[model samples]
Target: MKLRSYLYIAFTGTLIATTFSCTKLNEEFRGELEEADAGNIDPAALLINAYSSLNTPYQQEQRWVLQEISTDAAMAPTRGGDWDDNGMHRAIHLHTWNADNGYMNNTFVSLGTAIYNATNVLRFNPSNQQIAEARFIRALTMFDMLDLYGVVPIREGESLEDFRIAPEVLQPEAAIDYIVKELNEIITDLPNNGPTAAYVANKNAARTLLMKVYLNKGTFINRQSPTFAAEDMNQVITLANEITNSAKYTLSVAGKYFDNFAPDNDTKSTENIFTLFNKNGERGGNVDRTWNTVAHYNMRPGGWNGWCTLSDYYDKFAEGDERRGIYYDYAADTTSNRSKNFKRQNVGFFAGQQYNWTTNQPLMARNPSTAPLVFTREVTIRTSGATLETAGIRPVKYAFDYAVTGQRNNDWVVFRYADVLLMQAEAMLRGGTGTAAEALDLVNDIRVNRGVTLFTALTLDNLLDERARELYWEGWRRQDLIRFGKFLEAWQEKAADPDPKTLVYPIPSQQIAVNPNLVQNSGY
Candidate 1:
């Protein structure tokens, strides 16, 4: 894959200053520079802005919290005074979030910025490749925005004020149609899958995006009814076939499975279809948050000790699955910077008494637990008051970059072939042309290779569990739960009787405030 350098290009100072002031003055600002007037501005840089906007959503783990933390797969426990972002984290887990919830609002803004930047690229008379890549990024952004918010604000040509007035909102069907049309029109212009095609969108990447949109079209259109259309499922199957038949990807297994997330994953993993390229400290990136959220402060290259996997979800993995990669190791003494004192754990769930590697003694937790920082299997979904440091089993799913400061060099995988295969299996089982036996085999292939026990039969519930085990912390949990008709089901500390409106996030309060045409999702 081409090493995508994260480049920051600054527009004119006057333009930026005016734009910020316009936001405060309640006036719309537009990037209206024409191709001729662009002077020395590189058209590719504008598209880079669109790609950079991805960092905005995934940067601070906002999407992960929305997708994984809100679902039963994971949670950001409020450890006492820490991680209590004004109850935002807790609200998501409990499905009690309102329109003003900070994280939801941030997500709304981040995706909107992606649309704006992509539109900027389209405004210029760029080459076909630039146009396709910009539209692909725009389509991907809109798909997620529509999926989560149930409405997409398409920023039409060079005029934000006019566009906002009676902004055309693309609801589920309209959004999917729009995205599918965009991908289909541009797939031929995209680059083919190869070593030079990792970070950028390729034909397979577009197909994968189309597959995802088609697979979840039913849920996006009507979460309440959510009847999988045969045509959509067939589209999913067809697209999956294109990706698999290309033979450009494979399922990473056992010893090499972790390579998909390690610091050098971009070079080692053959499975990543679309991923965010990151070089530590060059431009701020997100791989750090994956490990930082779970690693103990006492461990070398310490973590925030905030987020952890829910125990019930942890149990989904079979006993000897290599994917269940958590194990206790030596922890470092922060006071003296020595590593021989306490045991550190990574990935999956951590529990029981943590031991010091030096004297094999119990180390005290910061939260003053009676036991030696024993992380428990059970945790309150809503941690309102004091939450102990060792309350839940920390999940360190991605390989941590202990070598870097602040940011990690690991490339974040957005779509992998394994996920593509599973999507095909899902399409087959969900009323597509393929047989159930074939679907089970597709899933078992992943399971056996990952060194996990295989299922004799595949139930809808079983498939959901398999997805959780295989793709946990990769940001597919919420989507999977909703499609499987289980998003509103009660689990761990969440309420089963959640409102159907909870399926889609409320159109952020600020968005509705700015654009009256934007309607809030049903039950906000």
Candidate 2:
């Protein structure tokens, strides 16, 4: 797609101005950062900007909204007027979205902007490590674009003067190849997994991403009836094995499962392979939105009372699964200014009466005076009943940061070791590269850790259900559902969409309007 000249100039000016801490600039040079002076620019600053660009798309609103709300795992129902957003949430959950959808348009733009910012780093005098990091970021954004839109616009080394020229669009197959090639080439220069490297582009992270690409490449190529080629599945197994051999990661056990998403997860989580770092009152994605988005207003550390999982998805979790819900203690710190007087009531699914942790009193629903705030399992698209204010099963994936008052310290998890294990098991199951016993063993290991019973046997259906139970609301539901050939099936509030074209989202109409090379997906 063509990058508009004004937008390019504005982006460059903003990045340059922010990176250099320049408070003033002449009107004539306002949006022009001269290419001739590129030698003097700090490559590190540009790289930092590339990393920072990922915050919005991966966080609560843009990409997460598209990935989660459109699947059976989660939905943001319109509570009376709140979260209506002109039926955007309803359209996504119901699979009625068109090219004009605001969420789709914004997500497309955000991913595109992130790609541009990362690509901009390559044009500067960056070191080998910096170049690798930039390419990884660019590849990631491209992968997301490919996954969500079934196509990707690639602008290679384009200058501001060439902004009018539309970039070549890579179809699903070509996009997969391009991303695979980029990740493979950059693996050596990427950092090795470590405490400080979780937020950076690392070797294990690349391996994990490669596994995802290979595992889902079939679905990307043919979402309607995905056929996992033996070769691709083998590649997934191989890459997953590489990450396993790193000896740098392990699953967080029962009781500690929530630690992977805790405020201090950078140091506490053994499962996180790649994450976005957030520091209290500093810089990072709004990780606190993990709780605020689904929590009730009367609950301690009041939330917006939006977004929740369907009853069908919630039913997948068996009893005593630590991932379902568990009480987590965040004892108040008297000495730290960041710590609050209140604590979190629980850290997983909130299905019944909510409470104020500080007072041990049931939280009362704001809309219905004197009624307990009981989050219900039965929620409709347009809720209007006794449970209007607390409909659906609320998920608190990330533990509340009682310590941090504003921005949280929770590092948003992108890749985890548990996921790596699951992918490996799935690849083995699909490709027959390893015995069924081996695959069953791998899956049961995770189940055991999560406080669930070991399975006597394994199947694609059970594996898909296991993924849902283990990774709900972490933003892989839609992709997983599509890969399993069940995305179009009906569940909870959403109806079955027989049209295969619904598998891929429409290219934003505005994008197609600007760039003739862009075409809308089939069913839009």
Candidate 3:
């Protein structure tokens, strides 16, 4: 992802030059940030660098790291998935969903680092246009941390280390207010047409984030009244409508719905709002795994793990629904059996150096025992743990081939326009002024346009299922379930927790060790 390499390309000059800025601040606490390198790099560019930090592979919208505990999603390969076990990630995320620890803390701490960088640069000049953009980026990352783990410490000042050491002091509601209040500035200041409209922060990106912040203002924090405020809905709907009405971007052209998500093709697609930007040759993060995690066999040998999508969920689609095909992949074996592909893949050799998850052992079945193997070439697999049976399913939708790069495929689809439409519909439905009919029609448009044989009247359940079909693995399931009021309950019943103390994850221990003032979320 863009954020990983940011420490390298994004801030090398600024970080070095930042030493010179040191003289700009007073000798007191702000002194650390004031130090400067002789490079004289623009502080605004530093803030832009900070915004780019959020596009990390671990923390991107597909949530390669966070989806394991979701109700409809899970970490594939069981023991193979790190943080999926009791060591740290699993204990904090899987064992308990509500508390803050491990995965939650890592996400918090990473975002905190970005915030600290942004704030440090902003401190030099808060009124600068770049400062506003930096603040917007910080706000976006903070939303992920705050909503996932409530009442986090919100100290803002200089340097990554300075803000980090300050304290984990709990924030008042004003802290949340500060984020929302700051967006007005960002929205006004960001360009009507910014750098690479698909990836950079723009007016609409600011608005979309504003909608999210307001929608969860009450529930995420212990505010008051309904968690989703009526006023918040109005703002959200207005923003969604603005994006919808804009001729700048629209839904995927007719039947090429997947075009919105087809990775290599979206170098300049209209649907993208903000995604982890990856130039084919510049990739430093392994982002294509989201597709690899649920891809079909043609993309990789021995097929993918076929983990998330299942027949139960797949059965909801009416015959010939194009949306349904998007979720599942079917391949014919040499013998002509229809292979149900649920998981998708990114190509690579054993222990795929680029997008392949593991390549230590060649999938034995796909290759001769005496065959000499080459890197990036996928060998066949002997059906066993993780490998699917002939009649079983393989991941399909998210799969892609990256022959050029070993592990860095510029093919991961993060944000899409279809999702924008659904968000608009959900905001309308939850806002209480909209009817299910409109939502139904929105879904049917995609289905019918895609050549659905039979269209049934849509209901709330149908809409939710449609979302699962349309947005699977794009990383909205957990939030969708929470909004649906089904996360705590379904996961609780599934895990059989006598008292399900999971609504959020626990703070990471590494962070707690560093910041004592920070308190872990309840029931950790």
lDDT of each: 0.74, 0.80, 0.50
| TM-score winner | 2
A best-first ranking of the candidates according to their TM-score comes to 2, 1, 3
State the lDDT of candidate 1 residue by residue for 386-421, as single tens digits. 456666777666665555566666777788888988
| lDDT string, candidate 2, 1-524, tens digits | 00100111224543332111113342224335553477876777777777777888787778988888999888899988799989988999999999999988888877887787787788778889889989998888888999999999866644222554566789999999999999999999998865445888789888888889999998898887788889998998888888888888887877889888877788788888888767764467778788788888876678898899888888898888889987665432222222443444377888888766656567789867688888888999998767679789998888777765887877888888888888889999897499999999999999999998999999999999999988888888889989988889998888899788889999988778766778878878
The C-alpha RMSD in Å for every predicted model, in order, reads 4.0, 5.7, 8.0
Best by lDDT: 2
Q: Return the clash pairs for model 2, or none.
A: 338-403
Q: How close is candidate 3 to the true structure, as a TM-score?
A: 0.73
Better of 2 and 3 by TM-score: 2
**Which 10 successive residues of model 1 have the least lDDT summed?**
13-22
Cand. 1 Cα-lDDT: 0.74
479: Cα error in model 2, Å? 0.4
